[model samples]
Target: MTATVPTSALNLVGKVFKPSELRFPAMPPLGLYIHLPWCVRKCPYCDFNSHLAPDSPLREVGTASVIPLKDARNPRDEAPLTHALPVDLQRRYLDALIADLDQQLPKVWGRKLHSVFIGGGTPSLFEPALIDELLGAVRARLGMPMSGEITMEANPGTFELARFEGYRQAGVSRLSIGVQSFSDSHLASLGRVHGGEQARAAVAAAVQLFDEVNLDLMYGLPGQGVEDALADVNMALGLGTTHLSLYQLTMEPNTLFAAHPPELPDDEVLSDIEDAVHARVAQAGFERYEVSAFCKPGHRCQHNLNYWGFGDYLGIGAGAHAKISYPNRIERETRHRNPQAYMDEMLAQARPAEVRSLTVQELPFEFMLNALRLIDGVPDAYFVERCGRPLSDLQGALKAALDKGLLDPKPGVLKATPLGLRFLNDLQSLFL
Candidate 1:
């Protein structure tokens, strides 16, 4: 038996909400990204926002000389073999990072951090105590969950057992070792400061220290053959790393590699390397969850997953970029690219270097660009939830993709088919 509501109560309950009164859907899980912009030396084939360590002895060396002098550190020096991370500069930067977070906190007030990624040029170069202090500051301000994943990107040349142990003690649950290649020739060709031996040592230390470790490897490198590429994968597998980020070397504009391109493997060899990497990692019980990302079961990178899922993240550091969601709109923000400028701006409490809201017409492509990268595409509901629109809005593009056999024909899932995954760019272009 149901009791009938009064007409007046029913009228109030069924009242239509005005467009302005309706609130946007709740935001996705949030993460934080802290970028350290200085590396011992910048790689020629790299175009990330990394720069050489300031005041290093090799600062004036020609780009071509970077590789040869990579291992020229004085053996007698008891200090860490890499370029020194100035204590004062580190303090200033950490303070600036805290201030930056303070400015961004209101946007995510009361939200717990899902994960944190401390990435960049060579985060391992900083002292472990400093890393601890940085993390402490973040935890104090942001309120990270006890079980949240905190990852720090480390380079082989700066590997130190004590340093790594200290990082583990300082609450870094994961370590991403930049072991680009285990082949000495390939490492040199890529302008890496560490050789095969140092890379191996770094991985060994990371595996022993952290429960979750990711080995970053690049194939199709200059003069690399299928055998060389396979060897790298095999060696990384042998190191017991739980995850791998395998990338193909590309020459981007404004990079030294673009100005004077190295002799890369031909198209055929490049294809072979890709094929071999896929087969080997799969055979070793790893799943290619996303493009360029392979991982053992339960070991996927949460911070990266947040990005691919179009979740909100606050990036606080030099040259860091962020995408945030609000009740009415979504916007992106970026910090100053120059380290000093970023610090100065943060100290001055200035607005972010840039901020822009995404127009409705632009949301679909931007959302798909990230979501479709995953082998298992995002849920259909996310299309409407994250993009602030109905799925019908994408009917034309979806129909075209299905007609071309690029999208799965499932009723409620938005995933690419095998053919679509192979021609990912073309498939994604349909959204635009």
Candidate 2:
């Protein structure tokens, strides 16, 4: 293979397509994304689609005051809201998720879901029985792969060994435990409820119950020195997890962090922290695949891989996002943000989702943003299969990236070299 792999091979592998000629097929490989919005408390450095509701709201918004209405003239107004409020504020409505699933599942009947990922404020806080019910409904309605990857995001403080065993019985095969950091000060700074010991115990429990288990860790705290960051990494490596998601503490918009910014480490210190942690993780036999993810052989998170590889997924629950690829269309969907709103909408048996199509110009960037994350990278066939276009379509831009030595020289793979990984944005910009 040449230093720069030829884009022409993509043309030979599949049908050629221009921006205008591209088409998105329905039923692109399916996955399931379940969102749990509530958290015990908010983390300062976190910006996930999560909410802080120490106590779950009562499910009492319905009946005479609030009614679901549909007008004959306005088809899109099927989910019309009545100008009335429910009298009950004391009722809780978590079961309303079933109503939402009942309404939506029929629309995508007969599709195989390759993976199911339950991410949340803290899914571990929910009763194990509820988890079992949720999984049972999923298996009955949307068929699961014979050897599917079923993952649930767990909080170390709320995690119980017996609960995990019950989850295994409920068909959950993977656990993504959020340990954040093992340092007492770091955990306190991040507002995490779990301690170092709890995190360790959670990992031990998860490894015993699930076939694959992932630990979530964060670096770049407000006062996190490089040594502090390394200590956290060392604790994570000691946990014996099969997978690790090491995220940098970024201050995103709309969060408390954005409003009341903390004194984060300087850029130079941050860079050193990243480099040292990366080196330590690699030395411990974990391969860095995505920017923040590392895993042992055959233990990479399949659900996340499906997302990055551009596979289709159905989002359920509050603030969930989904991408669906039909034979002639690709659409993204999102549920209501508030848990109460979501439960109400689900109870009424409405779509609870709005959809939009991806435009042609946006495809290359989205495709590359995901596919290039793997260290060894994906094969050429994956580019064709995932992007729904011949690999040749990206030749001109990819060639520029290869020439810049930002990409690996492998013919079948699309990996970033060390320098490329460092300057990933610059390489990605070529495709954009």
Clashing pairs in model 2, backbone N/Cα/C closer than 3 A: 25-326, 25-327, 26-325, 26-326, 26-327, 58-91, 59-91, 59-92, 59-93, 65-84
Where is the poorest 10-residue window by lDDT in model 1? Answer: 1-10
Question: What is the lDDT of every predicted structure here?
Answer: 0.81, 0.71
Cα lDDT of model 2 by residue, 1-432, tens digit: 112223443444656566555443333568888877766555555677666553522221122111122110112323211101121311244467667667667657777778888888777766666778788888888877544789998887665677778888888888898888887666766666656776788787788778898888888886898899888888777767889899888878876667776678999998899999999999999887788889887787777777777777888888888777765556788888888888888877777568788776677788888777766666665656556666777788889988999988888777788888889888878888
Mark the 10 consecutive residues where model 2 has the least summed lDDT: 64-73
Q: How close to the true structure is residue 115 of candidate 1, measured as C-alpha lDDT?
A: 94
Candidate 1, residues 195-257: lDDT per residue as tens digits?
888789889989998999999999988778888899999999998999999999988998888
TM-score of each: 0.92, 0.84
What ranges in model 2 sit over 4 Å off? 1-19, 22-27, 54-94
